[model samples]
Target: MEKQDVTANEENDLDDVANSSTGNLVDWDGADDLAKPMNWPNTRKAKNIVVICYLTFLTPLGSTMFAPAIADVMGTFHSWDPLLASFVVSVWVLGYFFGPLFLGPCSELYGRLPVYLICNVLFMAFNIACAVAPNLSALIVFRFLAGTFGGCPITIGAGTFGDLIKPENRGKIIAVWSLGPLMGPILGPIAGGYVGQSIGWRWICWILAIASGVGAVASFICQEETYPAVLLERKVRRLKKETGNENLRTALNVDRKASHVFGRSIIRPLRMLFLSPIVGSLSLYQGFVYGYLYLLFTTFPLVFQNRYHFNTGTIGLTYLGMGVGSLIGLGVGGVVSDRLLTKLSARSGEKKPEYRLPPLIPSCFFLPIGLFWYGWAAQANAHWIVPILGTVCIGIGVNMVMMCVATYLIDAHPSFEASATAASTATRSLIGALVPLAGRSMYEKLGLGWGNSLLGFMALAMCPLPWVFWKYGERIRTSPRFQMKL
Candidate 1:
C-alpha cells in the first residue's frame, strides 16, 4: 500500500506540471509571440506582400492617370490661362503633402489594412466626383481630396512590407514595390493622353475609378491585419474567452498614464518637422529633387508641342524615356545597395546604412550632366532624340537618388518607418505641387535653354550633399528625435 501511494503521487505530480505548462502557454496576455509575424509561413507572407503592392499601385494610378486630360479639361471648362490649367495637373501632389499628416499616424492607431480600405474608398469616391465635376473649382477640390486619400498607400506601403519582411531580404522587395509609384507618372500620361483625346477628359476619371474599384475589392479580400499591436489585441480577445479570464489583456490595448493623449499624437508630426534637423534636411533635399522631376514632366508636352510641333498623342510618347530610365536606375540601385551592405557588413562586423551611398555618388554626377545635356540640346533645336536621351539620363539619376533616400530613411528609422516615409512624401508633394505652377512662366523668361540650365545648375549644387551626410551620417543620426540606431 505504501509503494502504490508513492507511485500515485508521482503520476499526480506529472499531471500537475503538464497542466501548469499548458496554462502558461495560454497566458500570452502579456508575452511577445515570436510565432506571430516572424513565424508566419513564407508562402503566405509573400502573397501578402504582393497583395499590398497591388493595392498600392492603384493609389498612384488615381493620382496621375488623368495627366493626359489636363488640356481637354481646361478647354472644356473654358479656362484661358495655362497656369490655371497646370493646377489640374499638379494639385493632386498638393493633397499628397497634407494626406500623410493624418493618414499615417491613424494607420498606427488602427492598422494598415483598415487605414488602406478606408482611404481607398475615399480615393475612389473622389475620383468619380472628379470625372463628373461640372466646373474647374469643383474638379480641383475633388482631385485634391482624392490625392489626400490616395496618400495612404504611398506612405504606408513600404512600412507594411517592413512589418512582414526582415531587413536583410527587404531590399529586393522594396525595389520591386518602388517601381509602381515611380512608373505611374510615365504610364499615366501615355494612357491618359490617348484616352483624353480619343474619348473625353471625363473618361480618364472613369477609367481610374473602374481600375481602383477592382483593386479595392481585391484588397478587402486579400489583406489581413498586419500591425503587431492590432494583432495582439485580437489575440488578447481570443485568450480572454478561452480561459474565461476577464483580466486578460495586451500591452497594446491598455493605455498607460505615460502615453500621449490624442492631441499630442496628432501634433507629433508638426513637432517632428520643426524639432528634427534630420527630417528637415532629408525632406528638403528629397523634396527639391522630386519637384524638379515633376517640373520637367509638366513642361515636357510644352517642349514637344511648341518646338517639334507634335500632337498630344506624340507628346505623351516622350514619357517613355522617363519610364525606361527609372527601370534602369532602380535595377542598378538595388544591386548596388545590396552589395554595399554585404561589403560593409564584412568590414564593420555588421551592416550599416552608410554603405548605401556609393551608388548615389555616380547618380549625383549624372543628374547635372543629364540636365545640361537636355537643356542645351533642346535649346539648339537638335534632333528630338537628343532631348529624349537627356530625359532618360535624368530619369536614371532621379530613380537612383529616390531609391537610395527611401532605403536610407527606412533603415535608419525602423520604429518610425511610417512617419519618416510620410515626412518624405509630404516633402515631395509640396515641391511637386509648387514647381509646375512656375513652369510656364520660368520657361517664358529663360527659354527652354536657360530655364533648364538654371534647373540643372541647381541640381549640381545639391548632388554632393548626400555624400557629406553618408560620411558623417552616423553623427547626425544620433539625434534623439530622429533615432537612427534602429
Candidate 2:
C-alpha cells in the first residue's frame, strides 16, 4: 500500500513539472521534433534553401533586367524626358518599398509557405501582363504590381534562415543566400542588354513570367511551413479536434483575439523601423548602399555607351566587373564570417551579434575609394578598364556590408527576424527607388569626377558606423527604449 501511494505521488509530481514547463500551451513535441524546421534533416533544409534562393534571385533579376532596355522602351513609347525614363526603371523598386510592409506581417500571422505560394502566382501573372503591356503607363503599372509580389522572398528570406539554421551556423548560409539580391541586378542588365538588343524588351517580361511559373510549381512541391508559432497553432487545432477540448491553445493563441493579432502583425515592422535604433541606423546605411547601386545601374549605360562608344551588347559587359567583385566578396565573406563568429564566441564564452560587424568596418572603406576611382578615371577618359576596376571595389564593399548587416539583424532580433528584415528592406527599397531620379541631373550638373567624388565623400562620412555599432549595439538592443513590445 505504501509503494502504491509513493508511485501515485511520483506520477503527480511528474505531471506538475510538465504543466509548469509548458504553461498548458502546445509546442514542439520535444527538442528533436522533426516538425521543427531547425530539427529537420540536413537534406530537407538544403532543398528549401535552394528554392528560396532561386526565387530571391529571380525577382531582383526582374527588377533590373529591363534597365539596359530603358532607352529602347522610351523610344518605343515615344517619350523623350530622361527623368521619365529613369522613373520607368525605379517605379518597380517603389513597389518593393511597399510590399514588405504588409507581406512580412502577414507571413508572421499565417505562414511563410502560403505567402510565398500566393506571391509566386501573382508575380507570374503580373509579369505576363508586363509582357503584353500596350503603353508606357500600362507597363509601369504592371511592373509595380509585379515588383510588389516579387518582394516576397526578400522580405522573409532572412527570417527563413533564422527558422532553419542556428545563429552560429547562419553566416555561411546567409552568404550563399545573399548572392541572389546582390547578383540579380548585376546580371540583369547584362542579360537585358543582349536580350533587349536582339529579340526585344517584351521578351524580358516573357522570360520572367516563365521562370516565375516554374518557380511557383517548384515552391508548391518543396516549401514547407517553417514558422514555429504557426506550426504550434496547427498542432493545437489538431489536438483540440481529437480531444474535444475547447481550451487547448498554443502560447501564441492564448487569450488573443484574431483582429488584435492581425492589427499588431501589420504594424510591427513599421514600429521596429522607426523605434529601434539598431534597425534604423543599420537600415540607413544599407539604404545608402542600395541607392548607390541603383544609381550606378541607371548611369552605366550613359557612361559606357556615350563615353566609351560601346554598343548595347557591349554595354552589358561592363557590369561584369561589379559581378566579379561580388563573387569574390561572397566567397571571402562567407568563409571569414563564420570563422570570426566562432572565434569571437569562443573567446567571449557568448555569441553576440556584434561579432558580425568586424569585417564590415574595413569593407566600408572600399565604397568611397571605388567611387573616387571610378569617377576620376571616367572623368579623365582613361582606359575603360579603369572605371570597370573601380566597380569591382564597389561590388566587394557592397556585398560584404549587405551580408554582414543582414546576418547581424537576424541574430539580434531572435524571434522577430522577419519584421526586422522587412524594416530594413523597406528603407533600402525606398531609397533605391528615389535616389536614381537625381542621378541623371547630378551627373549632368557636376560631371563624373565631382559627382562621384560627392557620393564618395558621403560614403566616407558613414564608414565609422560599423565600429560604433560593434561597440554599443548590445546595450542599445537591450535597452527598454529601443525594444519593440511586439
Candidate 3:
C-alpha cells in the first residue's frame, strides 16, 4: 500500500512538470483581444498618433528651425566660414543618421513607450542646453545631442502605426504622420526667418526648447506600449503569477536575457541595409532625393536673397512654394496610393507591395523638371513666381516619392518595419547631412544653371528605378541572396 501511494504522488508531480514545460505558451486570447494594439479603440490609437506626429514634427523642426539664423549665428560667433555655418545645421541631421541605428532596435527589444518617454525628456534637456550654450562649439554639441534624442519619434513613429493599423489602412495614417517630417523642415525657415530677424538667433533655440517641453508632456499622457512582444510578455507575467505556472512563456523569447536580445536587435538595421537588396536600392534612391532637398534648403536663402534681392524675412517666405506643394502631394499621394493598392489587390486577389510604386513613376519626372526649371529660372532672373512654381513641382515630387517608398518598405518587411525604416532613415539622413555642406561650393563653381542641371540629369537617369522595382520587387524581396537572417 505504501509503495503504491508513493508511485501515485510521483506520477502527479511528473504530470505537473509536463503541464508547466509544454503547451504553456501565452498569446493574444483571440482575434478580438482588446489588449492587442491592433484591436485598441480608435480614440486610443488617434491619441497616440497625435502625440507621435507632434514629436516627429518638433524634431525635424529643430533640425532646420534655426536655419534662417545661420548667418546671424556665424556673425555672433565671429566665424565667417560658410562650411561651419552649414555644419551647424547639417550636424543635427547627422544625428538623425546615428540615433535611429540604435534607438529603433532598442524599441524592438525593450519596448516603445519607455524609449519614447526617456528620449523625449532628454530631447527637451538638450534643446535647453542649446539655448544656454556660451559658444559655437557648445551650441553645436548641444544641438547634436538634441537631434539624437529627438530622433526617437522619427525612428519609431511608423512602427507605432504598424502596431495599431492593418496594412491595407496604413497608407493614410502614414501620410498624415509623414506631414510632420516633410513639412517641418519646409516650415522651419519660414518661422525662423522672422524670429531670427526680429528677436535674434538665440530665441530660435529657446522656442524649440519650449516646444519640446510641451511635446514631452503630451507623450507622457498619451503614449502607451504598443509593441506586440512587450504586450504579450506583460500578459504572460500576469498569467504565470495567477496560475502558478513557473514555466509559462510568451511566444516571443521572453526568457532571453535583455542584453542578448539587444545585441541582436542593434545589428538588425545594419543587416537589413547591407543584405537586403530591396532596402539597399530604395534607400540609395531615397538618399539621392533627400540630398538634393537639403542642398536646396541650405542654398535657398543665398539663391533668393542674391538673385531675387529678397531680405531675410522674405527669403523665408520663398519656402512657402515648397510648403504648398508638399501639402498637395500628401493629399493626392495618400488618397491615390491607397486606392491604387486596393484596386490592384482586388484585381489580383492579393495585395502586392509593388502597387505602391505606380505613383513614383510620375513623381520621378516632376523632380528633374522642377530642378531644371528652378535652376534656369533663378539663373535668368525670371519672375520670382517662376522659380517658386518650380519649387512646387519639386515639393510634390519629393513628398510623393518619399511617401511611396516608406509605405513599400513597411509592407515588404511586415513585422520588421521599424528596422527597415531605420535602415532607410540612416542612409537618407547621412546623405542629407553631408550634401548641404557642399551646396555653397557647388552653386558657386557650377553656377545655379549647371549645378541644378547636374542634379536634374541624375534625377532623369534614376527615373526608371520605380518601374524596375514595380516589376521585380517581389522576386528580389524573395531571393535568398537578399534575405536578412535576423
The local lDDT score (0 to 100) that residue 105 gets in candidate 1 is 66
lDDT accuracy of residue 137 in candidate 1: 96
What is the lDDT, from 0 to 100, of the residue 317 in candidate 3?
89
lDDT of 3: 0.85
| Model 1, position 481: C-alpha lDDT score | 47
Superposed Cα deviation of residue 350, candidate 3 (Å): 1.2
> Model 3, range 1-486, lDDT digits (tens) per residue?
435643554344334334543657766655766667897778878899999999998898888877777899988889999999998998898888889867876787789999999999999999888888889999999988898899999988888899899888989888888888789989999999999999988888889989999999999999999999888777667666766877777766643466765566567777887888788888988888888888898889889888878877777888889889889999999999899999999999999999998988887788899999999999999999999999999998888878899999999988578778988999999999999999999999999988999999998888988989899989988877666364
All candidates: TM-score: 0.89, 0.93, 0.94
| Model 1 pairs in collision | none
User: In lDDT terms, which candidate is top?
Assistant: 2
Candidate 2, after superposition: displacement of residue 291 in Å? 0.2
lDDT of each residue in 1-486, candidate 2, tens digit only: 435643554444334325646545666555765667897778889889999999999998998888888998989899989998888888888888889867876787687999999999999999999999999999999999999999898888888888899888999999988899899999999999999999999999999999999999999999989988787777667656655666766765532355765566557777887888788888989999999999999899999998999888788899999899899899989999999999999999999999999999998898899999999999999999999999999999899989999999989988677778888898999999999999999999999999999999999998988999899999988888766454
Give the lDDT of residue 76 in candidate 1: 90
Ranking by lDDT: 2, 3, 1
RMSD of each: 6.8, 5.4, 6.9
